[model samples]
Target: MLVRELLKNFQELANKEVEFTGRIRSNRQGKNVSFLVLNDGSVIDDVQVVYKNETKNFEQLSKQRLGAVVYIQGKLVPTPNRPQPFEIQAKISEIISECAEEYPLQKKEQSLEFLREIPQLRPRTKTFQAVFKIRSLLSFAIHKFFNEKDFVYVNTPIITENDAEGAGEAFVVTTRNDGKYEDDFFGKKANLTVSGQLNAEAYAQSLNSVYTFGPTFRAENSNTSRHAAEFWMIEPEVALNSLKENIDLIEELIKSVLSYVLENGRKELEACQNFFDDKLISRLESAKDSKFKVLDYAEAINILKEAVKKNKNEFEEKNIKFGLDLGSEHEKYLCEKHFGSPVFLINYPKEIKAFYMKLNDDKKTVAAVDLLVPGIGELVGGSQREDNFDKLILRSKELGINFDDLSWYFNLRKFGYYKSSGFGLGFERLVMYVTGATNIRDVISFPRTPNNLLF
Candidate 1:
């Protein structure tokens, strides 16, 4: 039986015979008695097994090393006054596989940085086990949220000829030893997709509401804690939705997922709280319960400028102006210090945003929005797409984007295309925010960063 099931039904299964097969997390033994903490990875907590010298292979069981796989036939005994609710009194015990003495994960506490070196075995640790379990639950909650809202899930292509973001950060896809493009596999230049928004938009025109949850690649050489070379994105496109409606949907989705994790992942959250961040649960609750503050880009710039005026060294980038792009420091200050909750900054300058965003009436700013949370700076980014073909072409030309490459995307505007809105949420960043994991590498199973690609 799994530790989660055994613990959940301990009240009814007390004093009943049960069999458990799992890895040994900790082994404490005396001459007569041996205690083994076993974990099967179903949950963060482990089951404790107490065995006396009467059991078979008693000497081997007593000397069993950590990380050894063991099977135990035992009876659950209730311990009301102890920290754990119940303990297993082992009647029969055997080592399924003995661990080598060179196991790296000793009983001593290790740093998160040190654990990153062994991605293959770090999941056995309680910290990563909790983080990954919460990640899995959050992923399921995302699908549930969109499915209940009648959004059709679309699997976008991994390789495409067009760059959706036009940021020139796409990883090139080629199967040629020589540097010839025309003789390549696709017959033309192809690259791994950076965002699935363009493809999801094409489906939204027909399905009304569609979402794409898949892996996207970026070729940037960033080694920050928040950036990763390969990551998963959750992009959802809705037809006929304005910027305001898009922001509302983002808010609803965030709150719904937060509530789901808070309710369903209580044990994992408790484990995270005890180890990583103490304010993890309360911070998530605050975000779910509070109404997200909506501040205009102009007003936010002014707020930053006023703060800068009060203190010269308020921000590292010192220049808080109208058209300047908001950095991580600026974003964190706005949400963490100014609002103390999630803040949605809207109507950014057209120069800083993508060419696909809808131009507002002022013609200087686009109808774009960025949702900034407390610890993590920007959690979600979205905007209302420009519906006019002429304006889109003009914007593309102004940004030096090739018109021939995206001719099919341009034709969407000509063929019964109306206003649509969508956003891209970085799955790793969301996991980091929810799990209180400081680094993006901690949340991902095998993170693909600039210089790290260990399995």
Candidate 2:
């Protein structure tokens, strides 16, 4: 029987014999009685087993080390006076696997930094178990939310010849060592995709709505708590959707997923709240209930400028002017201090945004939007794509993008393509926001960073 099953049905299972296998989380031995805390990863809590000296292997069982696997045949009994509702009275017990005395995780609490070094064994810890559990729940919630909306999921190519973001940060994919691509595997230069939005857009032209959830690669050299060389992205493209409709879609999706996690991941959230952040649960509730605030980019800049005037040292970036890219500090201030909720900053300068964003009638700004939350700066970024062939071609040439590589993408506009809007949400950042994990490496199973690539 699983620990969760046994605990949930303990009243009906009283005095009934049960068998289960789990790893010893902690053990307490007395002169005559011994107690073992066992967990099998089915739930956040563990089960307590009591065995006395009457057992033949009492001495050996009492000496079992933490993390040692064990099998137990026991009877469920109510513990009216104890903290827990019930426990197992062990009738027979056997050690299935032994653990070494040199195990890294001991009784004392280990720091998150120390746990990062042992990624293989970190999942066994309570903190990581909760973090990963919430991660899994969030991934499922995203899929369910999109699937219910009748959005088609598409798998884009991992290797491609075009850089979707045109940031020149894509990892080169080639088999030749001489830095030549004429005779390479694909007979031309290719790279790992940084975003799948461009490909998903093609499918949305026909499917009307499509999404891509997969791993993306980047070659950035900076090492930060928020940046990773490899990460997962959730990008959705919708045909015939304007900028306002796109914003509505993002708000609905976020609220739906938040509601799903809040309903389904209570235990995990409580575990995280007890360890990582004391107000994690309440903050999530506020986010799910509150309406997201919307502001124009120019207006947000004015607000920041006024804040800076009120206090000269309010922001590190003192020059709060138009057309300047907002930093993480600025974004957090807007959402955390100014609005106290998620804020949507829209209509950014065309020079700062990607070339694919639709240019406004002013010919200076693009119809781009970024969703900013309290803790995390930007959770989702999207824009209404430029549908005019001539304007897109002009933007591409202005940015000096290789026209030959993106010929197919340009052809989408020339064909019968209509207005399409979409956005990319960083999966790791969402996990961090929901789980209260300060570092991006903790949420991911095996994080790929600049200089570290351990298993």
Candidate 3:
């Protein structure tokens, strides 16, 4: 019986003979009796088994190592005053796989760095067991939210010639037969996609609403806690949508998924809270209940400048001006310190934004917004796309992006271009925020960073 199932039907299974198989999490040998905790990865909590010296093979089973896998036949007995509500009285025990004495994950706390060295085995730890379970639930929650709203899930291409962000942070896709990439697989200079927005936009124009949830690659060399070479992105595009509508969609999606994880993933959440962050659940509850703030970029800049002058914070980059692109520290100050909740910083200067963002009436700034949260700085980045073909061509030229490479994308605007917008949310960052895991590496099962790719 699975631990989760046993817990759900404990009243029915009480005083009944049962059988189960699981790995031993802990073992203790006493003079008259012994205790063994078994975990089958069905849930966060393990099952407790008790056996005395008279039970079959009790001597060998009681001396099993921490990671030993076993099969057991037992009777469920209620323990009203014990830590666990019910305990298993063993009748027969079978060793499925005997563990060596060198198991790394013992009944002791281990540092995150030390566990990271053994990524393959880290899932057996309580911390990652909770983290990965929450991560999986969060992914399912995102798909459920989009599907319920009648959005078509589109799978975008992995390799492309166009860089949607236009920052040139792409991992070049190549097949080097003679020490150079002269023979490209796609017969062009191809690179992994930075965003799926451009492709999702074409589909959204026809389908009304569409979203792409897949892996995105970036070749940036920065080794920050938030930066990863390969990550998953969630991009949602909708035709005939305004910037305000886009913001509303984002807020709804965030709140919906957060509520789902908090309500349904109580076991995982409690485990994470007890181990990682004591206030993790309360923080998530606050985010779900509180109303997100909206502030203009100009006012945000002014507030940041005033904060610097008033000695509110010794900002690393103290010169917070109008045209300056805000960093993590500035975003944290606005969302965490200033507004004390999630805030949408809107209408940034065109020079600091992408070329596809719609140019404002002033022609100086563009229609862009970034969602900033308390613990995590930027959770989502979105904008209203430029629908005018002539303006788009001019903007691309102004940014020095080759027109030939993006001519295919421009064709969509040429035929029937309507106002459309979308946003990209980093999947790993979302996992980090929900799990209260401080480092990005802790959230992902296998992290890809600069000069680091382990199998």
lDDT of 1 by residue, 91-130 (tens): 8988899999999999999998888899899999998898
The list of candidate 2 runs beyond 4 A from truth reads: none
lDDT of candidate 1 vs native? 0.93
RMSD of 3: 1.4
lDDT of each: 0.93, 0.93, 0.90
lDDT of the structure predicted as candidate 2: 0.93
Q: Give candidate 2's error at residue 297 in angstroms.
A: 0.5
Model 3 off-target regions past 4 Å? 177-182
Model 1 bad stretches (over 4 Å): none
- Give me the overall lDDT of model 3: 0.90
What tens digits encode model 2's per-residue C-alpha lDDT throughout 1-455?
88889888889998899989999999999877789999999998899999998765777888899999999998889987988878888988898999999999898999999998999999999889999999999999999999999999999999998889899999999999997898999999999999999999999999999999999999999788899999999999999999999999999989998899899999899989888899999999999999999899999999999999999998889999999899998999999999999999999999999999999999999999999998889999999999999999999999999788899999999889989999999999999999888889999999899889877
Instruction: Give a tens-digit lDDT track for model 3, residues 138-198.
Output: 9999999999999999999999889998998998877865535446677678889999999
- Each prediction's RMSD over C-alphas, in Å, is 1.0, 1.0, 1.4
